[model samples]
Target: MSQFDRQSFSLTGKVALITGGASGLGQNYAVALSLYGADVFVVSRTQKGWAETRQRVEENGQRIGFLEQDITAPDCAAAIVQHVIDHFGHLDILVNNAGMQLRNDVLDYQDADWRRVIDLNLNALYYLSHEAAMVMAAQGHGKIINIGSMQSYRAGKNIFPYTASKHAVWGLTKAYADALAPDNIQVNGIAPGYISTDMTRSLQEDPVRGPEIKAHIPSGDWGVPEQLMGPVVFLASQAADYVTGVMLPVDGGYLLR
Candidate 1:
């Protein structure tokens, strides 16, 4: 703690596996990790939109790998961890970023629709983390980063399941961090608020809600992917070896206002 070690923040020679990594914030996470010297592997439901992911990583002089499979698929937890180990010889980081949100009236929401959100957002994360934890436990070190949201702390108008799932995400992050601390694995989360992405286009473009959102944030604007790059790299590197069970908010002071 007395001396600064920039190398501790480097992810050189690490292997990272990211779920839903083909596009959006997930893609950004992959790119950022790779730029920090990790060989990134992406997993998602389809092979579409991977060209850009490959171009970005390779352009930065880092190798990239891909696997096409629904993260919610049965046994995906074990398969994905094994797939990464097989491809890179060992796994050092796992990013649980695959998730969905549905804006529906809670009173009229169907059970199937609710399950769809929970299955993908919460259950898949749990499964993947469990498998990755075991793999990391054996290796004596690893990093697991979960993507939570401002909703992980507060509920929205119609995203009932997303709110529930993200709150659970925060809980699971703590639980896993405590459970895996003995194995030298740090489990943490990033709770983003009003990030400018395709997923939040509707909300951002909403004439009525958009301004209200911008006005509410202390920064007075939506956050960009690049804004999250530093925290992501820090959490995944040796710099965060003693940091765990914590939810780091990347919000533009939205929670404060």
Candidate 2:
């Protein structure tokens, strides 16, 4: 192969499972991976909105599957993993991107809310990664990309549980990387800054807070979900064979300023 062919980051013949793949960042990750030639399986609670994502992936001539899964359930991870294995016969990449955020101060936060946030953001990721790692270890190669957040390191107002869970995600990424690196499995994180997704649509529409956020970001523009595709595909491809346990900021330099 020539240098150009050798350096291509195509995921041809790989299988990827993305949680929360019906919308937002997860949808973008699924599409990007499929476009690069991977067969993608998208898992989410609702299948109502995935037509666009499915069409896009199929248009790329890649195999696509969707699973309606409430990942908050304790057994959800293992089931999803088994389903993928049964359908695709093997797994090569896992994207833990299913999460939700609610605005509530520490004092007013409810215990149930805390548990819900942690369960989906942290616990579900643990279960899914644990199951996926077993498959990867046996196969001797895989990539686990955990979706972290800017709050993984920094904090904002009124969202204590989300901040805490995101911090835990950072620690989990490193722990998994350390444990799986010897098995030829690379575990990493992508901490995105304020991206333009439905989740952040309300904030983006706010005239007051939106401008304030835009001013702080060096790029002066909120990143789109598509902007995240390149980094994710790189991390999942051969280009990142030696890169693991690092939190890559696809934030348009927001972390710097």
Once superposed on the true structure, which residue ranges of model 1 sit more than 4 Å away at CA?
Answer: 1-3
Judged by whole-model lDDT over C-alpha atoms, candidate 1 comes out at 0.92
lDDT by residue (tens digit), candidate 2, 69-111: 8998868788999999988999999999999887786688888
| Candidate 2 C-alpha RMSD relative to the actual structure | 1.7
Clashing pairs in 1: none
Residue 64, candidate 2: Cα error in Å is: 0.9
Worst 10 residues of 1 by lDDT: 1-10
Candidate 1 structure quality by residue, lDDT tens digits, 1-257: 24559788888899999999879889899999999899999998998779999999998789999999998888878988888889999999999999998888868887888899999999999999999989899989999999999999997768888999999999999999999999999999999888998778998999999999999999889999889888999999988888999999999999996
Worst 10 residues of 2 by lDDT: 1-10
